[model samples]
Target: MTGYDQILAEVCATGRRLTRAELESRRLLGERAAETGVGLRVLVRQHLAATRTIWPTLGSVDADRVLAAVEQSIDAFAEGHERAQKLAVRREEAARREFIDDLLYGRSDLGRLAERAVRFGLLLTRAHAVAVCQGGTPLDDTDPATRQVESALVARFSERRVLLATKGGLLICIAPADQEEILAHFAKLAHAATDGGRVAVGRAHPGPGGIVHSYEEALHTLDLAERLALDGPVLHAVDLLVYPVLTRDRQAMADLVRNTLGPLESARGGPQPLIDTLTVYFDSGCVAAESARRLKLSVRALTYRLERVHTLTGVNPADPTHRFTLQTAVIGARLLGWPQTEL
Candidate 1:
């Protein structure tokens, strides 16, 4: 091992605290590795495993004599060691972040990735799933519940083969397989911690490529939920796939609604009854009697509503082409939050 490695081993064996002699040696390393005294503050805190922490100060006191060359050398050694330690930590952190970014982006070499995964308790060959959670985690790995998720970076969830990190303002996590009940429970704890953080989970898939697929799907679910103004603490991609596909073209959707259903909105007061009538009519499989029964409207009134739809939209529900188009438009309307959207 190198001299620096030996020094670290010695430090670790020294227990919870350090002596004045040890501090003196590290101060020099701190000075050498740190660009300035200001950045050295961060270096010192990291050396102490505490953020923004400063060295203890003492009140003014009289000293008998000045320090000798040996004393000065000892002080420089301590300072330099501290600085070197911080620099080493920064390098390791950057490398780890790069690996995670590569894995998430599907750019990592599989053989190397698998080796790295093994060191981190991840078996990449197993089934995997991804989740994109919005917001920060309330609890750190010190809690036993999050121990399984805890990595050197303090990323975690619960008992599952999982990796976690925050990137682009989102908490991206990968877990072994998709366990709906377990994930749902995790969702509850997470939301409770943040008082309402949104989460999007993807279906589980096998192998490394599957992990990438899950992450993309989860991200897609989040985008879809945002575009559609959907609300829920946790949303699954399976539940949201249809809406995302249907609303891919908002302009086209708005235009279709305007040409097909806009007329009904201007009729008799507002669009509520017309929307309700159409929904019920379709729900009843275009059977006037069944729709009337469900709507609690007489068959004559239901027919009149249908007739009004035909007169305004120039599309009769009886025509298969017209019925299919109108039904698609209504579904689009709901997904795009139409009429209410002022489109």
Candidate 2:
């Protein structure tokens, strides 16, 4: 028989809902029937009833029996449309997730990226940056912050072009490059939502390959921001570029803190007085008077603290060479969480 007859036979034989074959047949037959000004539903009803009317006329079969057989099949087809629509929706969603996951994880093939890109209505070749929002834990598709970020970005930018995914307890977004304002905008929203958590934005990079680069940048940004305790609702990689290097060698960092500031930290009154004095002294550009004023201490007391620092560490913050070593040590100490966490 025709394509339509085969679809109907299969549905009747298996008692199945509308299959893909049936849906395709409906599309074609519906288009043909529309030429005669008949809607799909009305045409389908007429076609189903034809077996009854035509069989009686040809004196080959009972009208009632044929109508009953085909009419039972109508309900199944009706349910099939909804199932078909849902299936289509689910398939599209799955594909979009795959496209995003593969892109973020750098598993997407460059050759096939163009084809997959078009399927999602996105151009993978555009300049892009990845932003990661580390809010509360157990974050996923249902998280409110994630939902809000997705809604805000897509509302402003468009779903086809942006890839937003929440995995491994973080929300990662890949969007157009130079959208610094957009990244900052969402950062504030997440900040307010989490009562001030961390939001890391990476430097913009070029093309599809750039997505992974940007993702790496964002990850490093977040890591450094946490290590350095960098402030602000939105943290950019550019702001703390030097921090990553400082954090790279944990053993070296501990050694630096131990060798440089370790002596002062062990002073009679604990490290705060010396540490605070050193920090303010460094902040004041090695000016005795200004450092004393900032610390609300007399110049004599500040001098004494500086002398004590030199006495213990054997490096004066005033001597250019000694100051560089001491300053570097102070910074390394902070980054290594020294004193707070035992050298």
Candidate 3:
């Protein structure tokens, strides 16, 4: 048996358990733990001294072996102690998560918890923003990818305090104090993961109490953009509000063609039919044959309309320059949401 095994067996035979208190007392008697605290080498020397006192008649090799066994025991004990400490920390972390869930969802006293977390320096007490990203896949089932993405984001924004969680297909992030920086970082990461899958981003909002508010706004913006078939990979909240204006403005520009070329519409028997023909004409890449087919008019009838349009609007229907002018007027009218007075 090893020297440590013999010593441990003897202690067990004594029928008195060597509690931590007893071990500390023995350490004090030899100043072992104290000297070791100063330096690990000092602790090794103290162990050697203790070994000689414990076994005086042993030969040199036996003494060295005994000392080595004791050192190994010390290392094992230290490792066990560290492992125990980590397990305790993990348990405390689990409890903290439970508490946070209760407080954030309003099941517990949030005010009290907030004050305590701030006082204990566990969390910042100020306002924060919540950003939710949908990575086009379930994060729970894809642990490795989720971890890789989370690690990248953490490394990229090490200075910013962020809390991340995964629910369903969403990667939820709580950013403290610097929402814009976090959002931009997330956007870049999402773009880099283009080959992985499509990612949809939501808006960011001020927090403390406004996290949900902002998260909802971002989700709504994403939904609107998607419904309208906006280009993606990165969808901004403001774009939803802007795209409609551009679309409507394009139609208004078409209206201006009919209004400016009024004499042409009158000859065609009505402005509306002529305007519809012109819209199809411009929208179909200025192809006279396509516009004539769409309007169910002969090519000759379409040509007459074009000539009248040129005369009234002082623009050639066939000329690229005048085509641009007609297109611009339609866009301006739509964007301005023009009434008769504005037109």
* Per-model TM-score versus the true fold: 0.56, 0.65, 0.48
Candidate 2, poorest ten consecutive residues by summed lDDT: 52-61
**Candidate 2 local lDDT, 124-163, one digit each (tens):** 6778877888875657877887787777777876634666
Best by lDDT: 2
Q: Which residue runs of candidate 1 sit more than 4 Å off their true CA positions?
A: 1-78, 136-160, 178-182, 244-311, 314-327, 333-343
Q: What CA root-mean-square deviation does each model show from the true structure?
A: 10.6, 7.4, 12.7
- Give me candidate 2's TM-score against the actual structure: 0.65
lDDT of each: 0.66, 0.71, 0.55
In candidate 2, stretches whose alpha carbon ends up further than 4 angstroms from where it belongs are: 1-90, 193-195, 248-254, 268-308, 318-321, 337-343
User: Can you write out model 3's per-residue Cα lDDT over 99-122, one digit (the tens) per residue?
Assistant: 545434545565766664553233
On residues 183-252, what C-alpha lDDT tens digit does candidate 1 reach at each position? 5655555555445778899988887778788888888887777755577889999887777677788888
Model 3: CA > 4 A from native? 1-68, 75-79, 92-96, 99-107, 116-125, 140-142, 177-179, 190-204, 219-230, 237-343
lDDT value, candidate 2, whole model: 0.71
* TM-score attained by model 1: 0.56
How many steric overlaps does candidate 2 have?
0
